[model samples]
Target: MNSARRFLLSFAACVALALGMAAPAAAQPFPLTFDAGWNGAGSPPLPASGFWDVQANWNNNFQAGTSNNVSPYAYYQETAVIGGDLVNSVGDLIATFAPVTVNVRTFQDTLGTSASSPAANRRAVAGVLVQNGSTLNIQSTGRLSVLVTYGTNGATTGLPTPGTGSVAVESGGMITIQTSGQLNVVDNIDINNGSMTVFPGALVTAQSINSGAAGTIALSGNASLTSTGSTTLNGTTTISGPNVVFNSGQVFMGDSTVFNPVITGGTHSIMNVNGPVTMNGTLRPQITGVTPTLASSWVLWDSTSTNGQFDFSDDSLTDLPDPGHRYNVATTTVGSVHGTRGLLIVENFLTAEVDRATGAVWLRNTANTGGVNITGYQISSASGSIDAAGFTSSLDDDNFDGG
Candidate 1:
């Protein structure tokens, strides 16, 4: 080859080699990098791991791509918000990331005392949509409350479908779901060792709720919860403490169930059952036992031979002008109430019938075995005395003597 020809050929060969060498280097994966102290610059997109957290103060909102990650290592010094849900063109809005822990620091715990960290309510997350499989771990003793809200639009609209995700409140953490909105979790939940509190008039629903070994649902301290659905609490439920109350309207069918409610310490609680309760285990309380006071209400009790001591009367019995009646009991079954303690009132009149054979008394004329058996005895107090025949005669039994 001549000089010019050789030069061109040599240059082409060098260019090909350089291009080949750069190909692999350009394809190498790089770690995600973003500015933490600033916001409004558009949330940096994350990989399949949709991990994100807010600790101190983030005024702006964060937007995620496929899977992302955000960890706020300090207390929320300012208000921080998550931008929007991640939905690709093909159609998938999954925000599954490795567990995220927003460490909440306490100045008192650090310098005040010798302890560096004290469990308090400093590390809490309020208002946002936490992608499914994302965990908000309350790492420090500082408390952590996660506020999850579903928008009118986007993947977080909470459509009840399969493949839906959840925001797990793991151990060393205490999360409170404040939204009355429903969270559609296609999978199960894990709240074994953590503390979770959902304030009054709040409704929480899950695909399945399974707590600690034996399915324990402890109503700790003065905290109270009102939950609905089929729950299996295998642990002891203490329903006492002046402030501890759990008004659970749970109804379980007749397979086999367990409840662990307590009223010990100084806490107080009320186990209210709106529907049927079937407990295969025991109905235990924290104190000595449940107390039934005279009230203008119906105490409906339905149990097999396994049911313990209970007192139920008609609602009219406690229908005075003042003082509403209340029933008290302690039990280990955490899903339903142990008993209903009051008179069942219906319409204007209070009707009750006592059963002899079954010992199951009922009101509204549904307990007498064969018609209203008066026992052929009359109570004649003054003029209202029990004659030789079983008849009610007196102002006490006289709604209408002629009839």
Candidate 2:
């Protein structure tokens, strides 16, 4: 539904539940078909179009021009299939409460006029082509599963026609998940200049994320995001949480100006890509739980093969504590340690501290646990290199273990 009409419908659903409004005792709910006034409104003056939750818009046996709204109950928790197109003719947008599934058979926004239509004429849509500042909120009590194009009419009815429809959140559109809200998309999410925010305590699992040039995804607080397939992010992914996991497949990172992965204690953000990773842009890593000692290393990107490298010069690695050494990143084979090749940040320290008073030189064990040998190690200064045989004579009468 469009504008205040659509917002009022969502509000009314909440009020109806509070008022204990129930369907008729004889009414048996069934899968609703999106006829959308295709066959003139059964009731006059109400128009053929209506909201998804409204009783007048749905048809029980939808067959294009002959279907009628035989079902008297509004679809609250029933699985619905949008067969025909729903234009924002007069604010006929859709917003429901805790719907189990909303299958998009064809293009829901076939007309594609709502984006250019007036505010009063635009629909607050939840299906495909959710654009033009439309906001779809998944309540805490709701679990909305959007099954994108599969067959001719989604996964339910395998129509003869091949599925060519796709969903895109573009042009200021948003899908916000409230606390404890869950949204699972069977197909990839193409965020074309739009955004999806998962608030704290909320969860969103998608097949993959195809971020457009202007698209963005903000995972705030303790929200969890799991993308199963390959994710090629060309926009920004702002994550304030610690539970974002890219479990499998290749991940191509590109133009991520706001990507920051944090490391807290023994647990940190991980992108376990089973294939190659094409790296680009800046990856700002933060350490919160533990202090890094000399020769400490952390693996940020784990993959079988890496194509490119991140712009480390634009990172905040210098903010970390430097114990007479600097932190640098390198693409190395971590198979013996992590079973894959990855990009790791290591603290390289190899200088010795000399006690001039007693003429003692101390080389701390920064990398290994056992003793270190400096038998043939070169020690040079501004004047010249010290002779190995006569270097000990130049020092005070202090004991040298040589290890």
Candidate 3:
């Protein structure tokens, strides 16, 4: 071989090594932060930490897994049920127009072909639209329910039930997701001007329904709504996020939406709202049952400002325990047995019936325990009556305890 030939070979080898090192690494999704704050600017590059902070806020009941995550920084106004290995982070959400229900499964097999089981994946979630960072808006209007459950208790295999990622609605656009589910948001959801109902397990028809359940669903600016319901009992669920608004017609209580396996819910149920608000309803805000109930539990349903009017009618609700049922309604004070509604109802340990459709109050389930202690609410519009005897404050058999 000649000297020139050897030199040429060496130069070529060096060039190959340089090129290899210059190549960039593979790119990941958004949420590149420990606290998940996208800096309120443009979304930065994403790492493998598992976060959706850069573009929009998120909500779920299952504990999100991400050892390196900050539990849940900030709060996603979107209402969703999530459960996974979450660290120290605050949930982001809003519950003025609707409430996003989350039932995060703590553990399950995440490497299976399909989800956990057929029954475990037929659950439902309801709430309002979502939004985050700039115009990255993803509306989840109407009811967003999924048959998503973790296979663990009494179950054989353990798998993550990545249920159908479909935001079932009548008109909102639709799209399939990578695995989770899809979203649906119509331009408007007013009962008067607009009327459409999407059954469970259906597809959405909103503008931009995505195939991922981890993005922003903002409804900001002039985005105002009445937050109606599919049924009389389904209208009480309100969950969303951001500086959003829930105009005057905003009310709760009814069955337009539902939450099966009533586990736990309430305003403290994790509902975050911005802008003015108004709340109205008669259904139980939160549910904590050992057996499992439907249409119960909530994260947040705030309506504290006077600017927002809260209308409450004891009759606008349905499916509630009737005379034959064991359940009852009563008002109670902290220390005392039965408190007072001042003018509301529920005398000390008394049973009363609340008309959800007419806002009327009556007496029922007089065969129960004392009245449920009314923490610290004395404001009354019109006092109600309570049946003595059997009027208990702490009992669950009153609603579903079939005779």
Candidate 4:
């Protein structure tokens, strides 16, 4: 090759590198760092709020991956930094009203590894802030993974104090899933002061939903939530879902937990658990888009086993449509067809009747009973009077038990 041609090719390559728009290298786990600052000022200043996938929003034009491991997947393994600006280092991603897919697998900060005085610099800990009415959509293929953390720098003598990484959504911010969006969080979703809403036509299967102090998680409109690990409801977690399935773990509901499920006709919200449930919470059922009727009942939650019950200290049943009717939390053992055994909110004012000829007994309600599934109820009685000796009892049997 001639010297002139070689020089020209080398200059072109340098120009592309200087522009920071070089072609992508071979597929691998690479660092994609955010270039903007808290106030939208950095090497490549982005708007105060914008889409996350825009190439200019990242440093060195390092964009999020567009494909996943298998065919027809939206996201895959990606490691990205959230805060990297030297002057104003707090990374902010405000996605207002628009639907956004954070295709970056991990949002981390690497200042701990780069700076000399790691503790003195603010970049020691990397964090991302998603606020100002923003909505982030995380779509995954349900591949459970581990938590992504930051690295620590090595100073002259000993190792520097290790830094941390976090993702927070505050100020009415939401992490939601809609339409074909399915979120599978391999790590913890620490919404200590944020919200995560799984809308209708969407599903979210996570390892766990945790709150350091307080947070909110709402599910509504035929939405579903499947948790493989334990979930602690420490704050006001409102669930108006047709189904909330716990695959194989427990659920802890404390005093601060509140269940505000909306009933639309006979289709009310329910939590189906395959494991035990420990609750010391409150349930506030709301009737919506449907009128009050007789023989109506709503199953609050059902599980294979349960510990404590809701502390219904505050007259929560008064909010129902029928003010004159009575309500009670009835425990029912159900078959695998309907659901595992659980509790139900039914009309309390019931009349116990027995047919002496056949020993058939059933509950008759005169007031507005509301539409409730009566299949879970069973009736058994003693052969003789309460005061009689050698009294016998009938075998325990319910329709669901196939007896």
- Which candidate has the highest lDDT of all? 2
Off by over 4 Å in 2: 1-127, 148-158, 161-166, 220-224, 240-242, 255-258, 292-294, 315-318, 323-403
Cα lDDT, model 3, residue 58:
35
Please give each candidate's TM-score: 0.32, 0.51, 0.23, 0.51
Backbone clashes per model, in order? 80, 4, 128, 8
lDDT of 3: 0.26
Computed on alpha carbons, the lDDT of every model, listed in order, comes to: 0.31, 0.49, 0.26, 0.46
Candidate 1 residues 125-154, lDDT tens each? 222232223233222223333322111211
Off by over 4 Å in 1: 1-52, 55-189, 192-208, 245-260, 264-268, 282-284, 288-403
lDDT of 4 at 140: 32
Output the better candidate (2/3) by TM-score. 2
Candidate 3 residue lDDT tens string, 1-403:
1123223543453475567643222131111111121112122343322222212223222222222212121011122312112232345332221222121222111222222221222222222222211111122322232222222332323222222221222222221221122233322222211122222232333322221111112222223332222212233232222222332222233222221112222322222222222223232322232221222222232332212122332322233333322222232222221222101111223345565555554433342432333333232334554333443344344432221
- Candidate 3's C-alpha runs over 4 A off are 1-268, 281-299, 303-368, 371-403
Q: Estimate the TM-score for candidate 4.
A: 0.51
User: Model 3: how far is 90 from its true place, Å?
Assistant: 56
Q: What is the lDDT for 361 in model 2?
A: 71
Give candidate 3's root-mean-square deviation (CA, Å): 21.7
Relative to the true structure, candidate 2 reaches a TM of: 0.51
Instruction: Give the Å error, residue 250, model 3.
Output: 7.8
